[model samples]
Target: PGQVDFYARFSPSPLSMKQFLDFGSVNACEKTSFMFLRRELPVRLANIMKEISLLPDNLLRTPSVQLVQSWYIQSLQELLDFKDKSAEDAKTIYEFTDTVIRIRNRHNDVIPTMAQGVTEYKESFGVDPVTSQNVQYFLDRFYMSRISIRMLLNQHSLLFGGKGSPSYRKHIGSINPNCDVVEVIKDGYENARRLCDLYYVNSPELELEELNAVSPGQTIQVVYVPSHLYHMVFELFKNAMRAT
Candidate 1:
């Protein structure tokens, strides 16, 4: 989970107010919320089947749910080479709405369970010993991410609930007496200089094509985010001066 922290402070400058406003719905916020909800998926096999059995048969009409669920199932199938295909065998169609879907491990599949925060059932009842472990691990990670995403959405919803004015202003942390204005921070030059008090190299020397850190052996698993070499060097120097 990532913690939120950003601050900025400046003297209030008097400005006139505009006319009536029409703030359109923000799609970015909505997209972010959904992405989190689907982050982790394909919970335990038995657990998934159990929840599916309990779901309303009319659930397919919800396009949003179907969209994510289908993608999740396809992903799992591709990873596991699962040849099975059926609504009952669907590994990725599970999800929760206002009520979060969770799991609680318990012995015995035929105890006549009841509804709670989460419900469990055996979907892919049996799997070979070789693949069962990998399958379960994949679902576990998915489940954890799903919970994290939903919590983010819930937090965002609560923050904008019916209430008073919101505070968009931030508190800037740096006040480097040596730092001079150079254009509103592009990439990290200004922020790094403000936070650290120096620039390493000229912008002309920075290359956009570079790898940060790569995961070995797996070409597809390599990590890379195109960024400025100059910014990285400058930030490295700034980070070093903190103790000085």
Candidate 2:
């Protein structure tokens, strides 16, 4: 019941407007179709649980059956704890409040809705033959729910981070003139290389090529979020390094 409620509440909306940009080219057909699959799973699960909860109490009162109920409660509590930790961490990192708050608010909705349903499920059905038989099935759905949440959060992060990052860095640079753009990029690249080295301890040493599009007798200067750029480039480098 807890797993079912969690996935159902976190499921994708039918009217979701997610778009994929083709970073490599302008061809729409070449771009990947990225949409959260299994969005309707929650509704289906809610229905299944609704039916199962109607079973007789005699069938659900067994000692072994009660173990499943305890497991579901523990799982729900863990999920609630995770959401609380995320909220607290975001509060500690207020520099990116605007972007983080948006993600946090979405979580706030999901956490409560899932919590409410889990509470109701606990009250209605503690453990029964239907749930015991289907617990493994719903466990897989819970795993999928976590993965879906991660992908959704990543998409929102990239969007909000890009939107707010320029102003964020500018505000920082104004307070500290020593924050040089080229130097920052260089340091970011170095950090990424170190991370790659740590990850691939015995692999071939990875080399990153820095390219600049320069016109004759001109220098290029661009200002952006160093951390975000570092993450983007680091992911690319990590994949390339692994491919080798």
Candidate 3:
């Protein structure tokens, strides 16, 4: 028998892209209070912070998904808009859209196209990208999740599992799973943090689904006071999407 630790085996993605880097003065006491702190805000200086923290989870995942979907839909329509030979490619992309959309809608029917694409993507990852863990046993849910590309969309950003590369890529090549380890871990941790915050600001007793929200188009303002050379902060800002 052998003892294995997920953390010991992997270097977590550098937290250079945390969502809370914009918070106001992080105080000593505040740091002491929180767990797995991305950052902490002093109650006194918190008002000086600009980035809006409270947004729904589904909504959080939505903005990027919507952006990519817009891109995909446009590419698909270009294939469809008006065409000769393009018509068939358009039709193919259209069928992909239909099949994917159906997968999203419900499972009375999952995918409508050839089990061909299914096999195509399956072999791409080759059972498990990690190649160490029995992927099916480790992620039965992962396999099930891909049943709908709509469900997978941005949710699985890392390709085949390139640490941090987009999970939704049809094929993702990895040089070192160790090198790419941080992205997936950071992503999941960030997600859990966001979900916890969303749940907390809404209701202490409510379930996550209960906290789901309609888009509240509220204006968010910012005022920055920089004190240091933060390559990390710059990187985080670039990585963090301005919600569309």
Pick the lDDT winner: 2
Candidate 1 vs candidate 3: which has greater TM-score?
1
CA lDDT of each candidate?
Answer: 0.30, 0.42, 0.28
The residue ranges of model 3 lying beyond 4 angstroms of the native Cα positions read 1-93, 105-179, 193-244
lDDT for residue 186 in candidate 3, whole number 0-100: 46
Q: In what order do the candidates fall by lDDT, top score first?
A: 2, 1, 3
Model 2 per-residue lDDT tens digits across residues 109-200: 44244334444555666766776556545545644454444344444344334444555443321122223445555665566667767887
Say which candidate scores most in TM-score. 2
lDDT of 1 at 105: 15
* Candidate 2 whole-model C-alpha lDDT, 0 to 1: 0.42
* Prediction-by-prediction clash tally: 11, 1, 10
**Model 3 Cα displacement at 165 (Å)?**
14
Against the true structure, candidate 3 reaches a TM-score of 0.18
